[model samples]
Target: MSNLDQARVASRSTETTRAALIKAATSVFAEYGYDGGSVRLITQRAMANQAAVNYHFGGKDGLYREVLIAATRAFEENAFLDPEELDALSPEDALRRYLHQFLLPLVKRDRVSRFLRIFAWESVQPSEVFSAFIANSPPRIFRLAERVVRRFLPHDASAEAVTFAMLWLAQQPMFFVRDAERLAQPPFSLKFDEDALERLVDTLAGLSLRGLSGV
Candidate 1:
């Protein structure tokens, strides 16, 4: 092969290894979390050399960081609605629409469970990486959500109240996203097909409005 051909081959190989390492790391971290997940396990799953991670991502920490950044990116793309979309709606409509959009991430067919896994990791064993990742992520609709909620809350409403309400709203989707398998079976035996999801989202939105507005 000519020098140019050799370089092209090397580039392709590097891209392949990097992609594999990232994919493997996501599954490992989701399964074992950042602390328990090992470079060896990631590399084995990726079917790349162990040294490939060090070469591409610098180390386990770097690999884990990349994995989460990727997951968070996917989550944002699937979850957040544009704040501009709420501009034309009344506060009540905005709040209802916002809650519905927030839950949309949980309904993503492929990444919902993985995103839930990442959030669970954040809650259980947060690290500098998680903190930094959250800090740097672009403004989510949460800011708009806060504004919408504030319009209905009492004048004495504290930041804590708003945050608590948001977290409470989040739990509904989190349960469905994280516990779908169990939630699908047994005494609950709930379904989440199209009609069911719509009803659930509408119910959550209504409950959120009533609670926030003190209605």
Candidate 2:
């Protein structure tokens, strides 16, 4: 219609194309990984021009980097509790909620799944790209957990002792997710359903409280 309306339409079109590229690239990187995933494949999947990748994202590496960041942000928003939420909870309750949120991504199977896949690939192959991101991104959840755990520990406990306690609490779910595939099958046959997850949070919280009191 008018010049201003045409400019607005063009801006919306650019954003749509960029989002499509990122979405398609995420799947490509997840399936074939960075080295194996090509610009042509990503563009074809996005239904955007090949030149659009370079124009919008600099190149394939940059696009993959963006995908990783977007995936992580989604997980953070889904799984991380705000400081206010923790403030409203008691020490034990906070710990339980934190653990529950931390484990949510494993069961949700959304964008975070692709993120986890790419992360696993990077862990085995040692990519500079992922390494840089990890180095830059401080583990915010660790700090939150540490604060909650401090209330359970003795007043005289050392910082190192508190850190070790937090590590113990955090490691349970981390290792569980890593071994989930095997645990899902026969023999163990664990299912992380809603009821199971509630029990899991309760059990872990109880163990942590007992263990912390002993320390």
Candidate 3:
């Protein structure tokens, strides 16, 4: 092979390896979690040797971080607004957008299942590593939510009120994914399709805004 051709081949091989590792890591981490997911199992799953983890990802912790990042990939898309754009938005508009953005992570059915199932496991039987991960890696959208929500709060908004509002909003997506069938029954028989869920964002935003604005 020519020098350039050989370099291209090497680059493709590297990309392939990294993608394999991330895919393997996602499954293994989802199955076993950070504490139980060993480097050995991950390497075996990826069909690579142990050293590949260190070479590509630095170490197991780094690999796990990448796995978490992949899990959240959907959420990160279109998650940021230019500061100027956000500053120009009215508080109600900002809160409405923020609430809609918050649920984007669960937009895909598979992503929703994996995310909820993995986190359910983590929360029920969390390890020290899980605690550290939560403590260190607050989702970026959370700060955005708080910033907009604060606009409607009194100067001395109860800290718990702010947190409570967030938790209540959080429950909507959880219920949509977790109790989907229950939601689709006789009296409450609501469509849980993507469009329906998207519409849900507007409903929630309106209800939440009224309460927050004391309308």
Candidate 4:
């Protein structure tokens, strides 16, 4: 093999190793959380040596950051909202699109939702590490939803009204996922199938539209 060819192979191998490490770390973090997890566990899950974690990510903290970056990058790529396009859509369509973008991914990607639940739990009673993590990626969905609502709602709409609308729209998935036990009770059993998801999106959009129209 030529020297250049060998170098190319080496580079590809390194990339593969790094990707594996990130995937393993994301799962570990989702399962055990940031504070409860360790580099050793992540490396073991990846089937790579402990030295690989140190060499590739520098340490556990760095590995966690890479995991978050990878997840967010995938999220942005798959489901990003363009503020410019909001004006083109009718109020109902715009609101539906926004809610779908925010909620659909969480329902579909179970791992990401699990990781987010862990993150949310940590954020409530945060240590320094988790607090920094929350600061690094603050929730932008509420702000984005508020902006979209303002575009559709009357100028006289109060900030509190807009905020309430945003929260109401945002909580649809959380209500199901976070309250799984309650939802499983008699007459309240809710499954996250396609029909259920569509219903959720429609309900949130309808309610927000009514609120905007002062109904």
Candidate 5:
């Protein structure tokens, strides 16, 4: 084969290999947690050689970072939100948009939901990498919630109150969907469908506004 043809083939192979590694790592990390997952396991899952993990991702840490980056990029692209645009929207419109933007991606994409579950589990344990990730990305939904609440509520809402309300609002979707096993049992018995999710969002937004207003 010509040198140019070989180069093209090599580039394509590298890209394909990297994509497979990331996919494998995401699943492993999500199922096993960061501490439990290993490079060897991820490579085996990817159907690539044991050395492939190091070759494609440098190591487990690199693979973890890539998994996060890929998930966040998918979220940023598919979730569809702009803080400035949100600021311009009416309170109800902003709340509706924010809820859909944050929840729809996770609900529609099983991989994203799995990643989120992994993130939540890792975050509770605490680590330098997790801390840095939180510090850097933060949660846009909190700011979005606060802004929308402020638009319809008293300007003097306490930061604590706003934060609590925002956090609660953010948790509603994940808790209901991700933890559905518990939610579906006994007294809760809450079965969530698309319509139910919409109602939950609307109710949470209204509650946030009320809480912020001290009503």
Candidate 6:
């Protein structure tokens, strides 16, 4: 075979190994966390040589960072309205859209639940890599929430007050997502179908506006 053709085949093989490592590592880390998840186990799961992790990702920390960034990217992409779109809408409308998108991922529970599992583990015992990932990532949703929230608050509201109000608004769905399993069972027995979701969004929006009014 020509040198160029051989090089192309080698490139494909390299990427396949890298992708496999990431997929395996995501599952392992999600279940075991960074410290608990060993490189041996990850390499074994990937069916790749132990050296491949270092060759592709520098080491386990780098691999973990890639997995984290991958897991959160989809949700981050879909969960927020563009700032321009948010600006065009009235505060009530913008908030409703934002909250709707926030809850939209709940419908894709299988995929989103995996990501949530990874996040839950990290939250309890964060890794240095996860901290760096968060530090570098843009705070897209929070900024959107802050913009929507400012419309509700007086112009003179302090930064602390604005941040607190944003957290309060954002926490509504965050709490729901975190407790989704528990909320599914029990007396709540809540199902997040289209009609139910709309109602919940409306309820939260109403509560948020009223709650913000007093802030």
TM-score, candidate 4, is: 0.65
TM-scores, each model vs. reference: 0.74, 0.65, 0.58, 0.65, 0.71, 0.74
Q: Rank the candidates by lDDT, best first.
A: 6, 2, 1, 5, 4, 3
lDDT of 4 at 88: 83
Model 2 error, position 156 (Å): 5.7
Candidate 3 lDDT, 15-111, residue by residue in tens: 8988898877776765566677788888898898888889998988788777666655644653344434555899777766665554543454454
- Give the winner by lDDT: 1 or 2: 2
The per-residue C-alpha lDDT of model 6 at residue 65 equals: 81
Q: CA lDDT, every prediction?
A: 0.69, 0.75, 0.65, 0.67, 0.68, 0.76
Better of 1 and 3 by lDDT: 1
Comparing 2 and 5 on TM-score, the stronger one? 5
> Candidate 6 regions off by >4 Å?
2-4, 23-51, 68-80, 109-127
Best by lDDT: 6
Best of the two (1, 2) by TM-score: 1
Worst 10 residues of 1 by lDDT: 138-147
Please report the TM-score between candidate 3 and the true structure: 0.58
Model 4 score (lDDT): 0.67
Q: What is the lDDT, from 0 to 100, of the residue 157 in candidate 6?
A: 92
- Score candidate 1 by lDDT: 0.69
Superposed by TM-score, candidate 2 places the C-alpha of residue 59 at a distance from the truth, in angstroms, of: 4.4
**Compared with the true structure, what per-residue lDDT tens digits does model 1 show for residues 73-97?**
7756765465666777887787777
Candidate 5 structure quality by residue, lDDT tens digits, 1-215: 99999999999998888889889888887666688777788888888886777787677777787887876776567555777788888777887777665555334557766666555446345456656776887644455666666665556868876666666656655444445556678898877667876877788667655654563
